[model samples]
Target: MILAAIWACWTSAALGQAVPNHADPSAREILPNPVPVPAIRFLTSADFPPFNFRDETGALVGFNIDLARRICEEVDVPCTVQAWPWEQAADALADNQGDALIAGLALSPENGERFDFSSIYLALPGRFVTQADAARGFDPSALTGARISVRRGSAHEEFLQRYLAHATLAPMDDEIAALEAVKAGEADAYFGDAMRASFWLNDNLACCSFAGEAYFRPELFGKGLAIAVPAGHDTVRHAIDWALVRLKEGGSLDELYLRWFPVGFY
Candidate 1:
């Protein structure tokens, strides 16, 4: 049932690849050009690993923290990134506790109502993983009749139904179970978040390979990762957006991405 394929092979070595010279169009057109403030306070929850977490030395560190520091440097502003409780971060932002929140926050309308957001700096793209021997390139059309494993009730499942409706889906209770289905040869492939898939491939199962381009539909996967600022703080938002563009252009963004996600998915 599988037909032609689109090959876009990625490897751990690809993690160090240079960032593109240009910024994404979504970021370039995000704001109407605003000036940056001289100083800002950045808030984050340091409990999330790779993105934000406490180090062995008790220093709050990770991708978000490093990016925040780089953004501050790029904007020529004094900034402070402090760890706060995850649940309290939003309310703290609302209460003027900080100028920005850089913890892997998702973009949504409800969040848009209370805060401004920078253009997406990171994404958790969906991908397919197959056994190394059975690994092959894939496209939506190529997936017809293929047994794809997905977590029941997850956006990944919804995405497959909406886009690759021709494929047969094996809905499991959770991501691990779906992945296990592939590992056990019960399913042709597992469709899920690239982040989780990468971790599982590198640190857990060690029996699969990622296939195809990273899939990101904001409606299904969310608007990637962005920083949140208090409402009406266009300057702060714009500054972050500007810094992000510069970071992308200079490869700093990709550097941080490689640091956190050593395994490149896209």
Candidate 2:
């Protein structure tokens, strides 16, 4: 429930950082060696669709599921993905009920203290969406005086205040209102989660398009999705991180993204 609430709070409203590529000279050393384990039990939830969910046949499927399988392959270990209620999943991980958690989980200070996290495998960046006709590149000068709609008291609002202080801001109650402001021409653009904006453009409203490159502010959005292992489980954490880097390097991660999100935010 905690994870679900966290996801909902973030998603009901709106809704990549530059990752270090394989070229990073220290990439080899940065990757951790996998620890020997009889089996890797992955705990997740079926509530979060596209990331983690069950199909009509009751099979676990989604980006997170695929990534878990890939992790097992990279580690050369057997893996079992089990769907449980979010609270129980967290508890299970803490109780050693599972070797790792593959849910698309965001990290928080409390959670950070409770569990170790892998390198981000997925990031949700803040983006600007505007009317299709008005879609333009992101340039400070171009949007110098533009009106950008954002949810009041949101990370996006704080980002705009701190970075784009020169632009006029229109605060709205929620993601829908902020987007509607742009659709109605009340605001020059809407700054919010790229996923939500994509959904709006692809379904609810087709009149708007993303205006710029995705913005990655960890404080604003998050560190993205990562594997959550029990506290001090450095081996598992590092193993997941290593596998994730490989996935990113081999283009497997991007392929998975494309498969799930045809209308990608990145």
The C-alpha lDDT values of all candidates are 0.77, 0.75
lDDT of 1 at 88: 93
Measured against the true structure, the TM-scores of the candidates, in listed sequence, are 0.85, 0.82
lDDT of 2 at 251: 66
What tens-digit string does per-residue lDDT give for candidate 1 at 1-266? 11111112332335453222223445555543424487879999989887899989999988889989998888787889989999999999999999999887667778888988877666567888888766655555787799999999999999888888899999989898898888899999999988777767776446787776667566677657888999898888877887888787676877777777766665
Report clash pairs, candidate 2: 15-196
For candidate 1, what is the lDDT?
0.77
* Stretches > 4 Å off in candidate 2: 1-35, 138-140
Q: Tens digit of lDDT per residue, candidate 2, span 1-266?
A: 32232222221111132222222223336555544555678999998888889999989999889989987887777889999997678888988889898886569998888888876666677888888877755564577889999998999999889988899999989999999988888999999888767767766446887876667677668767778999887777666777776776676766677677756675
